[model samples]
Target: MPKAQETVLEIDLKALKHNFQYLKSKLQPSTKFLAVVKAFGYGSDACKIAKYLETLHVDYFAVAYINEGIALRKAGIKTPILVLHPQAVNFKALIENCLEPSLYNAKILKEFITATSIENQKNYPVHIKFNTGLNRLGFWHNDINFINKTLSLTKTITVKSIFSHLAASEDLNEKPFTTNQIKDFKTIAKNFEKTVGYKPMLHICNTSGILNYPEAHLDMVRSGIGLYGFGNSEIENKNLKPIASLKTIISQIHLIEKGESVGYNRAYKSDGLQKTATLPIGHADGIGRQYGNGKGYVIIKGQKAPIVGNVCMDMIMVNITDIDCKEGDEVILFDANTTAEDLAETANTISYEVITAVSQRIKRTFIE
Candidate 1:
């Protein structure tokens, strides 16, 4: 089906492929690669991105919740998918779909064991998340005995891998902390292997960790934002290609005289005769009010137009007085040249928040 000419997000699969290949080059032949497709592929359709990564031969795929894993499974994604934070309530659905859960704590571990036992399943694959200073979700580092006792009681499940989240692997200044986390993971992992009498796959490197700490890559490495063309550093970002381009068009052009207001609550008043271009995107579309009063802009006719007023729910007006533009003229919200990082910096946020906040109502166009 053809796309509407209004507002659209263009996803370049070629750029995605380039990023995957580039990140994969950083790994050893022995290390496995797991791609994250959670948050609907970081707000780009998960199923399509997973299908692409499958062809790239990514060994594993991870999602934050059970429903996301089920969605991918329903989409016919055959790769082994790990559900990062599966709730106990969704254990049945997860097992029914053959999705492996990352059992982080005692409650989840016990519940999953019981669930699998009820299903008459044996040696069902599961991942273990260790709390390596992220403190988000994971078994505590001191819980090795507890975990051993718990798993020994039930032969219904098996540990496929052990992993943790690196809180500051991207920050060069925090290398000391990152090093400690790796050391901690190694100590616990070594003991855990000894206790279990078998070695489970070990991983702790995130995208930043992947770029900075190759020694800690362990048996597998997970790439999330890097595969989406961000390396969390200026130097690393130079080597990656952005895959998503957000483009919109001017819905209307207003000629306002001096002292006239624009958008909601009279947030912006024209200082002189001005041309304002109203775009069909606003706070709801991920461009927030903090980007208002000239903090943010859009590229129109190869020129920058500053955002003028309070960003409305579905509209944002930009000053286009000096640039000749009209209704239906293409406006570049963000692209390779005008990057997500640039917009994120303008909003005092990060690229992940900006891209993920793009409402699902907007149509997405995937291109090679």
Candidate 2:
């Protein structure tokens, strides 16, 4: 909670716990919780967040790739890890690390089976992803028979779960679409259970899906942004708390004479006499160019200072004319109060883009 002396991402474990519990409260007692700690725990800190969540007994963890799962394993995470997208080349390492892979298509499924067999493994857990409507990944509903027939040929790999992704569960106007997606998944699960001769675990809900579709809670629910304190809606946002706060200190202050331009390309020219404060963070640090040219602002001494000119590689100048602040004073880019969502709105983006865009170069401080 101390003032930041440099650009840093402050992660509050307490807020994480609150968000986890808040989302967990919405699920059935028997429903499993899979915390998606991918993207460096939404650009906070994955290993630290996963370690903390492990203490709370989170049922499972998911990552976007194999190395992310490996990182969790390296961190001594004992809970099951599901790699959302696994490459064939890393199947050996995945098995070595005991990370389960989500086999979405026939090619990946076949390659993984071959890898498992070659490794002399038996019943290695794997998740089956079906493309209900997302059309991004996973097999089709008709591909169930292919998946079942393929699995029957090999005893080295076992399906641990059958799941799908909802296209837009957070948007109420897409209720019909989401409903149909859920219904399709249920059909796939049923057919899969019958053909495979047994039922693996079933899940299809993401963070927003968890809040909007309780009926589709199924056997497990995966949460990514929700655990980082975003609910995808104004009303639901009130119930969750964002855990990461991006803070920095003013490196210097400049008095701009009227009509003087600032930063590269002279993107910003002061119309009148103004005071600008330079902070040690910019596009390289994850405040993208879209947020430049007056689109984004930082909080200084309880006031908003609009960003001036184009964002630099490692710095940004904010108009601090009226703010009573000096060099070394603390500034907030985004936090619990002035959230990433609020800032992203200025650039026509979302909280996920802003938070996950935070560069790894920035120092991360944890508040336990």
Q: Name model 2 segments beyond 4 Å from true.
A: none
lDDT of 2 by residue, 284-358 (tens): 999999989889999999899999999999999999989999999999999999999999999999999999999
- Give the RMSD in angstroms, all C-alphas superposed, for model 2: 0.7
Q: Indicate which candidate wins on TM-score.
A: 2
Question: Model 2, residue 254: displacement in angstroms?
Answer: 0.7
Candidate 1 stretches with Cα past 4 Å from truth are: 1-4
Weakest ten-residue segment in model 2 by summed lDDT: 143-152
Task: Please list the Cα RMSD from the true structure of every candidate, rounded to 1 decimal place.
Answer: 1.6, 0.7
TM-score of 1: 0.97
Error of 2 at 268 (Å): 0.9
**lDDT at position 252, candidate 2:** 92
Cα-lDDT of candidate 1: 0.91
Model 2 collision count: 0
**Candidate 1 lDDT for residue 221:** 94
Q: How much is 128 displaced in model 2, in angstroms?
A: 0.5
